[model samples]
Target: MENTMTKSILKNKCLIIDGTRAFMMVWLGQMISFIGSGLTSFALGVWVFQKTGDITQYALISMFFILPGVLLGPLAGTLVDRWDRRTTMFISDLGTGLSTLSIAVVYLLGGLQVWYIYVAVFLSGAFGSLRMPSMQAAMTMMIPKKSLGRTSGLMEIVQIGQFLIAPIVAGGLMESIGLAGIVMIDFSTFLIAISILLFIHIPRATVTAEGCAGQGTVLQEAVYGWKYIKARPGLAALMVLFAFTNFTTEMTVVLFTPLILSFASTAKLGLAMSLCSSGFLVGGLLMSIWGGPKRRVPLMMILMILLGVFSTMIGLRASVGLIVVSGFLATLTVPIISSSNQVIWQKKVAVDVQGRVFAIRRTITLATPLVTYAIAGPLSDLVFEPLMTVNGALAGSFGQVLGMGPGRGIGLLFVCMGLLTTLVTAIGCLSPRLRKVEEELPDAVITQSAQVKIEKKLPSLLPARSPRNKIVYAKCHDLKPPLPELLSRD
Candidate 1:
């Protein structure tokens, strides 16, 4: 028994050391790949807009990019679980690189069409759906559960790099090297990403009896993801919370560019974007070092409320200074909120099933953005903007506070969305299930041996109980009063 315990402790210590090194090595390569993909995205958006001079056409590109991922998410996740994670990521990167190369080839041949771009981007998105869930699930094995929050924080820094560096670099390169050159650079980055994955060893999730029982046809596995979440009420409620939050956030995102352009120049917009993304960079750095509060759910809720307040502040004025401050603060909250929430899911959900569960969660939450995108433009053009005009009805009442001018109506919409986000978060906090999620759901990765020892020791440490009051507990850490004792208190 002592030898077994000694081996377990030593094993855990080694994992603590090796896991950080392995995760960081892979993370560095993915960071390079993210920057490259961002450059391509920026360059392509510019190319499309310059070609057609229509905002709708440019927007369609984003729609095409996201639609495939959402539609194929469940099936892709099932495949992710079935395949080796490193191999899955390698294939995804290779396919996306090929797609990018094809675009460059088309452009070089003077045969590049809008349809060609759509098809290529859609293919890339489909592959991305496979890569992301695989990567996320693999991380659960690569990093210790205790470090998941910090690891997510590091991942957030990569996103900040993409957002902060890509556009500026892509804009400069477009003038000197042009579209083909930029795309070729992106392809090179993919090669780097693939090469790193080839050299690294990522441990796979241990398939339990429950996981095996659910495996069958691809369709059954895909459907199993939904059923799994349905069985876990806490996880289901969390997904719904994010879906509503994403819907409101997307409405703000779709309108943000136009809102700035209405009163500010492109140069000012660029500066504002840089400032905003820097907040993410700083927030990520802090979270990586500090981790977060021990009780992460409450921290996440507080950050969500802060985000809502910042979102409202963003639309309170047309002044560039206010927007810059608000945008920076709003973006700053994202990494912490995301990191906290990710850790909750990582610790609670079994890693073997994470690929499917996370994918379904992604699919459902992302669906709201599509709906929000579809409605945002029409709502702004026909309803909000018209209502905020100087001569319009609301101009005399609400418009006075928001100001009667261009983009002011959109400002009103921003305020409404922000308040909705805040209200939803507030209400969600009141739900006992959500508030007690960490207490109710057992940690899926707890060492079975350790749990057994705890269970054996627990009864001796507590008061004697009647036969009817005794309960078999799977999660020893969550020991609490008997059900009748709790019900009597209620």
Candidate 2:
């Protein structure tokens, strides 16, 4: 079975050259769409806050945006595998575009309400659930195995742009274009994305026996990803590590705005955010060029530890400079860590089931943010703030170190979350299963091929007079041992 699989893979490898061009076309369209989406998201948040003057209401907009994707991810991913990936992307973009268009029309008609925005956001999220996993799975097919890391880094560049450029542009545009105009721009980008995808072809995964077995129902197929992960202890451990890491990071994310605002003006907060976002841009560029460390697991763990350290530093001082520096350093690690982790998944998971597997991974990893966001506010107001107050119980010890006052409580919370993140990373690093994941998990895509020698007489099988071809084909005696045996020898 192994030999047969190896030979099959070798034959198909000739069909897939380095897919840099194809990947970039799709990536460029998606990046443009993401920036447009970000513009609308920032504009909407500002609009909602302006109208209601309630942080909770503003926060709920984000909640609505995430909830649908989180709830429907498994189903969406299953469908992504079942359907043509390019078609899935087209439908997702079209649906999201329509949702954004509805918001624009509603606003124009003066019938726009908070509930309507929520509904549109929910619909966009549902479509995104389908779009993201399908795109990821398609990437594995489009790019050569060796280039996945660099491809992930390039992908990060698109993501970083949303945080780095979108807000500033959106803030400026709101003064001239207004919310309706901003949403229309977002809709237009979606149309562009759909148009780009229409010209592309994304290959479908070849269903294996295991994949076919789970296709009895969508629910069964959805659960298949989890089962697949469960069977791989190393992969399961990696997921758990990321889940805890994501939770800690998200808790810090929840507190960052309030923490910065407690001491600095809104202008300074924006500057700090921009500076932090630049870190992602820088990190992504570096990863794209350098392709990260060869040993991805170790690099990921180290980056996590660095992230924890920088996160802790953000709360050590209330100064704007300190926050800026710490925030930048903390965010700088994000792209590298994310890309490194993605490379591991791309290498380990089979392309056929990556959609479902990545979907489950996304669902599990993102669940933490929802929980953290729900509790962060109450925890700060009721528990941490009081404890960090001047007259509170811990005032003499912890309060003296972290300081007491407006944002002090959130600062202390940052410290605790940072420590938790560091400890989790340390534990993950020490675990043998996680530490040796690369060795334990065989590469799903074979990079090396067996050397074959074909006689000049076999002109039909061997390309005649091809100097560009690097494959060395020998006489029949050299190839008779089976390709797998030759590959093993090499």
Candidate 3:
């Protein structure tokens, strides 16, 4: 029976959700929902900016949107594994949609305010925090190990694709249908996402020793992910890498537009963002078709270097077209880096443990964005911006060539950021620990007899005999002494 269950999982290549189908279905849902959500988010940013005319205050909305999820990371990941995957996704979509619908109601009632938007964004963040890990674990379980990298690439594409189109669409939608209309469309997308999840099936993960007889309470289960990470160096290193990358990107994001807009206009900003988005989309398409090479880490390292190069170029010239070209180049490297990371996690960890492990992974890594939110703006606006200007300290020596002005202030920030990114990747490559992480890590290979063999072998290894099979345990364990006397003494 154990063998049968294992074979069933491995053999299917069709039937709507035999792993491969599950990937496509989930991908489609994510693709639609992401674009719609991006549209609403951009529109909200514009609405708040127009109303308040304060960049800091407007930027505060993003904080309200993602912080709750970071706070709720552990709880969300644990509960996702306990609950049904489809139901988890459905509840997430439905709850988030309801939240969006409430904001639309405020607009209808003529009682909308900035505070209301903050509240809505916070609630949406909380729901979404749970939704992401559940989806990650589900897909990991659903896909075969060999195809993991391409799937990871495909996910990055879907994620970045919306960012590419959402702003442009939102900008246009704002002109025609207004903010309220845009949100209404967002609400509809949530409903659509829920419907798509309904048509698919995700296999239930086998309960583990951690969740079974030696079971943890909810809090312990939440920390199960942390415990998993502590045991694996590969995952730990990846977490650190993501933290820095997230923080650096956040800073670059702050400087990128200011530097570009100085040479070009705000319209040019949209074009640059679109070009970046295209790079990711093309990478995803490549990943989906070709998958990745057998060795995942090398690809990741190369992509990181590519990203660093493009990042430096953004700092080199204030030319709008040049910066926009760099943006395209910058985005091209993302899918490669992201897919490699995902493939590593999926291959190294057990499918059953992924919910807690990946969730904790997200908890640690995702929090870096908040760090970006905390540091990027201030560093650019205060230290970097001021120091590079004509009257600032560095002006006398190099500021003349570097230029000593408002935009040049941000140029200093970009150069420093590009150098930091390159150095981090270089250090990562130099470390034998990170470079051969796969060699040190466990690879989860699903052999043809995987399930039955593991099950049969486990009882022999355990001291106690289960009620269902004392005779079978005796045979499996090859008992040399009488078991009944030992059982009575125990």
Task: Give per-model TM-scores.
Answer: 0.87, 0.88, 0.87
Candidate 3 lDDT by residue in tens digits, 316-419? 66677777678778877777777778888877766556767777878777688788778877877788778877789878755876678777778777777777
Worst 10 residues of 3 by lDDT: 464-473
Off by over 4 Å in 2: 1-18, 446-490
* Model 1 lDDT, residue 263, Cα: 98
Count of backbone collisions within predicted model 3: 0
Error of 3 at 384 (Å): 1.4
Task: Name model 3 segments beyond 4 Å from true.
Answer: 1-18, 208-214, 445-449, 452-490
Error of 2 at 244 (Å): 0.7
Specify the poorest-scoring 10-residue window by lDDT in model 2.
448-457
Model 2 lDDT tens row, 124-222:
888888877888888987777778888899989987777788898999999999999999899888888876664444544533333544565889889
lDDT of each: 0.80, 0.81, 0.73
Candidate 3 — which pairs collide? none
Q: How would you order the candidates by TM-score, starting with the best?
A: 2, 1, 3
Task: Compare candidates 1 and 3 on lDDT and give the better one.
Answer: 1
